[model samples]
Target: MKKSKISLETSFWAGQEVENPFEFLEVFFEYANLDYYKETLNHFLLHTNKLEAYEAGTPGQTFIIYTAFRSFLKACFSLKTKDKKLKVRKAPEKWSILGQASLTSEEYQNPFLVFQKAFDEKTPDEFDFFLCEITHLSLSPFAEEFEYDFITPFIHLTKMLDAAKIISERGIKKNKE
Candidate 1:
């Protein structure tokens, strides 16, 4: 996959020296995987979640989360591509999320808003909405493959989903003030 490049000066997070966001992501999605993760998306999200904790809002998390979201969709695409019933092969290679978000608080194009809307619904519509979103949008510029290197609001939604699941599965609860 051909990856996009950004200058070191352009990619640094606030008060933190991080490598290019996409470069950091390539380490997991492209270079190597940890045995404990059991899945690439899990491993990738784990580290991004950690970094997000390192500093609340930063450009670094954007890239990390962006890659994670894309990686998540890539895995989903791989599974559903061959299933004619799903028709995932028709979706855009880079921007694969399901809906078109007309408004956003941060950087996002067409589909990022779509994901935010689904995730915000707080229902089971996320994946199902994505399935329909992929088949419905116009084909991206690339016909076969593309390596995208930017983060958008969609990544934030994935983290929210993970935390919600972890809070329940891990039995985490907030203490009343």
Candidate 2:
């Protein structure tokens, strides 16, 4: 009998790559039988989600959201590059979400606009979109061994939005008290 080796490399990108960055999580759960990994990711999202209660219009909310998002993506990339040391690119302007400019005055007032657009479409928000974009660009060099299909970058926006609903629920309970 001959033995066949499976390659760790993944390809599954069509022209229209799915907009949902969290799609990988679904695939991860479906194909991989690693409960601890699943639990860890779930916990991370829950904890992060707890940090920011989404109020329609609030100052400083964008900063909090951006910081949490940056950290989350960094952690995810670290997992992907476990073997190799990950370093910030010198020129973030070139190909990194870390370089995205601060929100303008209007946006600063209502960063929720981005979230609203994404919510209406039932797709990942702009941050998730950019995260996936940067991930693809940065990992292009390693395309041969890149696990794009499974590591489909961004944490889903819907998950965060869903978590926000808990805030309103808690408020209702508090009011009843």
Candidate 3:
């Protein structure tokens, strides 16, 4: 299978170092088993040159790509975290039920907004919506735990998809040779 060579550039926020957003996204999508998203991205790459050809003559191609990419991102955001175990920490303070509820609600809402902001600014040529979705996921409260537990397996799958996109794009170029 061919892989996509679409590379994502990483950004730093608030002077703190950030992980490669692309890597985080790759893992999130893999963990969720979003095959449709993968397939659509693959299809896009397979016809990239054709699609690029249309970029100037047909404005609809842009929307088609944008909408499809957005849908792919939505799929990633909808994934539920399966792990429920709470890790123990030293000197933990007790909290009321209401406090816990507040924290959970805040966790849910903040990440979504952060993701939306990130998604809105992402350039379609460099980053996909799926990557934005993963960026949001990585910022969530339990991302560290999730990463520690599942990042390895997720990386394996993402690498396959990445390779496919790269190969497909390359194949298109080779055909012109």
Candidate 4:
């Protein structure tokens, strides 16, 4: 039998052990209060939507897709920090959504305007403070007062693979339909 070449997509998903590692990590990291896993999942959903729009003759939709991609990158970087709690602080602020939308608006218009408007209407609550406190605690390690075990690159790689798998499956299903 002839051996088939493994595509980049296949390699990426394979790295995740073909399981929903993000969901697992979400539960695991819940105690850290970083919500990093949840953010990652959100980013994936946004990207999937953007890609679907693009394929349906809405090229302008790439704006949202690209924004989600950038957000995912930021989340990945935050995951690299020693303090898991601080990872939330490293997450891009809502302003980033506006900035990205601006960059892509000349072509697609500002799709994020709706999100910005909604955010503006909401007031910060106890949950917001709680999340901030967690972020502060995570960042405290960099203040020379605490230390944390270094996160291995393998773990990050695995998480990324899992995310990619979910994305690929979604994309494939969309294409097929």
Candidate 4 has its poorest 10 consecutive residues by lDDT at: 82-91
TM per prediction: 0.22, 0.21, 0.23, 0.21
Q: Model 3 over residues 39-77: C-alpha lDDT tens digits?
A: 544443333323133234554544444443444333322
Off by over 4 Å in 3: 1-40, 47-58, 80-177
The Cα local distance difference test for each model comes to 0.31, 0.32, 0.33, 0.29
Candidate 1 global TM-score: 0.22
- Highest lDDT model number: 3
What is the alpha-carbon lDDT of model 4 when measured against the actual structure? 0.29
| lDDT (C-alpha) at residue 1 in model 1 | 100
Which regions of candidate 1 fall more than 4 Å away from where they truly are?
A: 1-28, 32-62, 81-177
lDDT by residue for model 1 over 4-107, one digit each (tens)?
Answer: 43223312222233343323333333333322222423333334323223123453543453334444333222222122322111223454232222223231
TM-score of 4: 0.21
- Where model 4 places Cα greater than 4 Å from the true spot, the runs are 1-56, 83-177
User: What digit string (tens of lDDT, one per residue) describes model 2 on residues 78-168?
Assistant: 2222213222212222433322223333322233332333345432334455544433333232223332332222233333332222211
lDDT of 2 at 135: 32
